[model samples]
Target: MLDSYYLQDLDEEEKAMHEFNKDWKLSGIQRLFYNSLVKQLGGFGSEAGKFIWPTGVTNTLEGDLAIKDTGNQQIQIFSLDGYHKQTFSYGSESTKHLGDVACTQEGLFLVSDGSKGIKVFSKEGEMIHLLKSSKADWKHSYGLSVLKSNRIAVTDWTDGGKIHIVGVDWRMNAILKTNVIDGLQRPEHVAVTEDEDLLVTEGQLFGRNAGCCVKIIDSERALKKTIGPTYGDHYSFMNPSGICVDTSGNFFVADKGKNNVTLFSRDSSLSELVVTQDLEGPSGITVTKNGLLVVTDCYHHCVKMYKYRQEFIY
Candidate 1:
């Protein structure tokens, strides 16, 4: 839910008052009013809905959406109205393929450069830092997650699947790949909850870790639970790739094989399908601060958004 109404949503006079009340969190009544107002003004981005092999996407806390166009090797920014705002590129010999991206609290973005390492860029698209672990052997880093504590988490698909954690100071703290349930193979995508629990989409096409699933790991990197069928079923989860957690702690998993996004409640006791519109091989997914859902459609080479709704707690 929207904790505070964006001043831009209000009239000139009301927007001033909204800014004045920024120090205070809005009340439930105020939130309800703004929620309704926002819904009334809702619309999708991009009239043509165009993209070029977009593989990853993230919802910034500022409500902006960032998409990585793999085919073009460019990062495109879109406003809530679906208008293209900016385009930036960070290409180098080693950082040719920008795998995934995550937005931080201070408008900083962390971009994974496959085996080369990670590159940090400011909100204005300036290159802030390029970090590579000298100790860890990184294969193809795809999934990236920035935790509430400023810690960075990313997955290495090769070397039997591994997750490397970067401390707030931008250094490798630890590597988590062992002690995983059912043998983790290709740990492609990852998401971290407010409580520091890990949600990862892994497993190869045919192997011990076949039939991808989302595994929840505690702060200690121990497996807490798992989602998805052990064998193929309706929920297919053929290649669960991108995963994210909402403010309410609900998880949205983008299954590339299933070509859809599924929602699992905070407690993981209930699950539902929350995406089907133009989900042609949906790969990466994220929920905005106010609960708007966004996902990257790899097959369709486009990005899609929806006004997230829930009959029960998501």
Candidate 2:
């Protein structure tokens, strides 16, 4: 549902005016227009399509999407527009439980599978390397992200949450968890920002501390800011399960309990619900280079795509 009038060819003055009107808080007709602009583009891997317990989703360097189907024990690939592309089957003893997926700039897929640590796969779906932490007792590898430097950041969903930094060596066929950030509650997913800071979704699984939140940790491993537990009076998260950052530094989070996706400004000064409907349990989330928002709904057993950025529309 595009505002085709805005999509029409406009004069330089109109284009400039549209740019000026962009990037602000939406309200009234503007909110309605924003709603229409951010629409469900397409979906794939539904329950009827034979996909079950799809947990993780990430954008590949080739602009495609890679999804981790935990129940089906396979990695499914799709176009940015949600068209079926390819599938990588994995049922080996090592990759018995796939959790989250992240792709490196070199087109390598890093998959998280509990105690098996992380498995590295080539673009052609060949297993290349296995990553395990020698320093810390490896427990569960849940969420994952690839940094600008090609290093990986993944969360451990054990009792004491941990974010492990993994180093890759393709030539040596060696990948190792090099560093660890300790002292998180139950970090479910993680995303690295343009500045190399980490945004981790963590909270207690139950009780009063169940107020799940996203923590912004600096490069030096210091807590910089925390968003949620509650935003204003209308927003409260049950589970902030998945997170991803956009080119503009704004981050989007998929809340499984709330069944919605929320956008947070880079500075953590503002937030808004971008996709508020039709999600049963959105888990893994990723934003493509072109700003397409992809979310995996585990409960609904489908991967949904949406046009997320307003500037991308104007």
Candidate 3:
């Protein structure tokens, strides 16, 4: 059911087209080689294993890094050097998992508790309030993104058909916005831009074409454009679970299936391959004000940093 050699399994006409294109052939070969090496190294064999799992990562405005140890069910804070600065555990024997976390200017943090909805905690990890309760339809509340307007955007993967756009106020009160967008197969991650636009990463679930792509939504939570498909081209994504936009409006996507980070320009005209190596189950992505790219390696239980090589245009 996974898309390991999904591209190679393309129809004859599609295969013939890529066979005649040298660049396409090279890209295919590179993907195959990378996959093989990863398998031999005991990593995920198929694309499905690369994605679908949940992990959270974010960079603080003050240049600190935080990663949720989902496997360990704890939160780990690290300095810019990747040192173990401090870790907060829910309880000694508690298995309550922490999904996504966002830090506010006042050092208050908002974290999602999977199906349990959102939890507000102080800097010392003390519970402040439960923003939203778990509804039977709200299966997996995965990604969280904070906005300058103090509104929190979240992705709920419960029904696997729609995304719930809930607004939260400073008092941690939840407001169910009238804006409920449908047709989302399995919305995994959500990101908000400076312009207040919403970006979501859709993953395949239960025979749906959710994997391998992202979608943009307007301020009204209306579907704007589909970025990629289930497979093919650089535009094609595979189980893309994480998305983040830089200060320049450029979009960075973590293609879990492809084991690479893809970059798209503001106008969607320019698409380029960014990081294609040294990634193990890269689930979440965030960019720092200093232009440093931070990615979460779910299986590896650590976050990796990348320096963006900015290309200036004349």
Candidate 4:
């Protein structure tokens, strides 16, 4: 994703070069100013109607943001600049514990609500129905990502771990589970890459070295790459929760236990790029279409936004 802000500085030849090379690279120096904190959204309320323990957030195609306010048991919609839009609760159930939220191409809101499975809602906040899996039962649905071809990928926390890939119509295409063959454990959050691959964050709350890493899985549920304590030198994670990818193939991970966000390059060379400024238990992360980074801080009860710059190297 070439930013027009930076493209204006390049010549015609440079622009053509970038057009030719879709998968370009940026040197470590160019990534020195990769991301910086700029704006903040919801916070602890002095009056009322503010965020409390917001867990997940995702951007809509219209550039608006929908956040899963778990403490309030509702979803809050806001503009990109921190303006409140509207709020809606999922389903008709009395007890609702929202986990994560994702917006489809057609503007439908898919939210994960504990044992209730994924709830589909209309743009006007009308409850559609619960997305039922064709195969595996949703033990504890935690994370969600709208994949290509209108499919949805969600994670189930119980029984070691399980990832179910289903269509918006509730047809399960495939399911990945934890066993001696796969090793997926306590998957928290998920993201779909530009190539349609899945990036899942696996971590545990009360264990060490059991599961604290990010795994890149293909469409067929095959493991591709793992980034964790063994990936790079000095790379470690306590609770790797939320994850998101940019159009440029660069991905970001939010570690709640570490209270920071880490940026991993495309080829996995740069791994220790940590963003810790003004962050307290960063829980969810998402990159905007224009390159702004949005993260939800669970402990502080607010959402932080960052402006990022990208320089491509041919």
Candidate 5:
């Protein structure tokens, strides 16, 4: 897609923003001087909220939202209005840092951490069951999504990683090392459509095919299509990691490499890039019913929510 942010035609608003960011890109002593100076003036200032290296975020069962604050080693739940409700903390350490989070149909939360496993918890933050690493190969699992059968899927990007399909209650179902459609290469994040279909973002692909893509599969695990660079502007990904499917079937993906997310239609017929400002290496992402995009940035030490292509009919 043609990014308005980089168009040579350069609109006034775009030029202003471009110039500002160009100046904001400081380093070494310049960065230190800028920070010190900004702090003296009260602060460099923040938009609304700041999250510590947040890696994942998703919509709760009741339509609320949750964020994985990897930098702080905690999971924070917030109301749609931005009110912080609850937080689950893990010890402060990157090796065991939280990676992803998702809400089940029953209102439960499934979270993955750097400890080589997944953990189930109540909405209120009580620990439920720990999905041990022995259950699947995605030790240090990086992605998660609850499938239509109530089953959950997690992805591992280790040497020769694979997607492990577990039961609805979080037990092993199918250990797919091969592909039913396009070879499942280094699956990272996943989302389930209203029809129980699956969409997985491939992270290990490089070069011409560029691992920046997603795979479609049926509820029964049948591969549907490989929606990647071949789909033209409507389909392209650069280090696409995070994803979430909305009620209407359309989904959003965070392309951390490109610092943007692409919204694809239910039928894979259309796409649009969004949230072109203040997103620094965006990783995990999700969309609300009101059409707001909530995402986390690995480099910016914050989480953000904003509006994106909401005019689409469905």
Candidate 6:
């Protein structure tokens, strides 16, 4: 028989014993570790009447804002003035985990459900199509970005790692000629450059500390260059998650480990910290048409809006 006990009901000694158990399953141990760490950091439990943890944020063509509430397993839409409009939830309340989201020019919404590949919906929240990745090869879909040609690029974190470029046609199938790009280690998020190059934030999984970095690759899937934790003596990044490029080719990276956003020039010559603090686990980032910056605060359970300072021009 299986025994169930709530960790919150356990005393200090019981909790300590749970942590030191060598024979306990690794998944259970990791859960205990996360719980203990959250408690120690004073960030355990819910946000208490606030918005749930938002993992992805995007602006629709109609200027509405859509946010993925990972904790609540729903997508909340809001007006530009921060007024809640509507929300959509899928699957059982206990099992839904929305990973990332993006909006296309045609008023279509694309969302990744970690295990369920990608789901496309209309602006009114109507289910249009479902694009499933290869279970034999692609395991988990973590991030997604839509290109101007109606092709969607997705980051899969199953085996080794790869990016699946799918054509959003009537059947929502992947193009055979331009399919997968190999050679990535736990790629979480993806950003495209002005010249059509791809940038990916890699190596930030649980238990594996593989020195996170960003990789720039050409259309042919050749690694042109890699920017590791330290570009020079002055700056570095840890567990970088979301990445986006502005009109001028400058890159903005959300470093969740450091809780700051770092701006990098196109030539990789200059890097500086742009926004820091008042952020709890910033995961995804994007620039709107009006030049405002939007970020997802995974732990704080809200999307933050930041305006660029007058002196800092793109």
Best by TM-score: 2
Off by over 4 Å in 4: 1-29, 46-49, 91-98, 133-136, 170-182, 310-314
Compose the digit string of candidate 3's lDDT tens values, residues 131-233: 7643323456677888776767767665664566555556635554424567777777788887878888877554434455788888767778778773235
Model 2 spans > 4 angstroms off:
1-50, 92-98, 208-211
RMSD over all Cα atoms, model 5: 10.1
- Model 4, 1-314: lDDT tens digits are 35577558769864553332222246222433333567788788522347877888999878898888877767788887677888887643223433689998888898887773677788888876776644547767888888877777878766788777765443331233321213578888999987888899987556776688889987667999888845655458887889998777878899887787877777666664446566777887898766677899877898888765443221
- Where does candidate 6 stray beyond 4 Å? 1-50, 92-98, 133-137, 171-178, 205-211, 311-314
Tell me which residue pairs clash in candidate 5.
Answer: 116-140, 150-168, 205-211
lDDT of 6 by residue, 108-157 (tens): 88888676457778788877676664432346777788776667778887
Residue-level lDDT tens digits of model 2 in 71-137:
7778888766556677886554344433688888888888877764678889999887777645644
Candidate 2 is scored at a TM of 0.82
Model 4 lDDT, full chain set: 0.73
Better of 1 and 2 by TM-score: 2
Q: Write the per-residue lDDT of candidate 5 for residues 13-126, one digit (tens) a residue.
A: 544433322221221001101001001000112222446577888888877778777766667777767766777764444353336788877877878775566677888888
Candidate 5 least-lDDT 10 residues? 32-41
* Cα misplacement distance, residue 210 of candidate 2 (Å): 2.1
Worst 10 residues of 2 by lDDT: 27-36
Backbone clashes, each candidate: 1, 0, 6, 0, 3, 0
TM-score, model 5 to reference: 0.74
User: Which of 5 and 6 is ahead in TM-score?
Assistant: 6
Model 3 misplacement above 4 A: 1-54, 90-98, 133-137, 172-179, 206-210, 230-235, 311-314
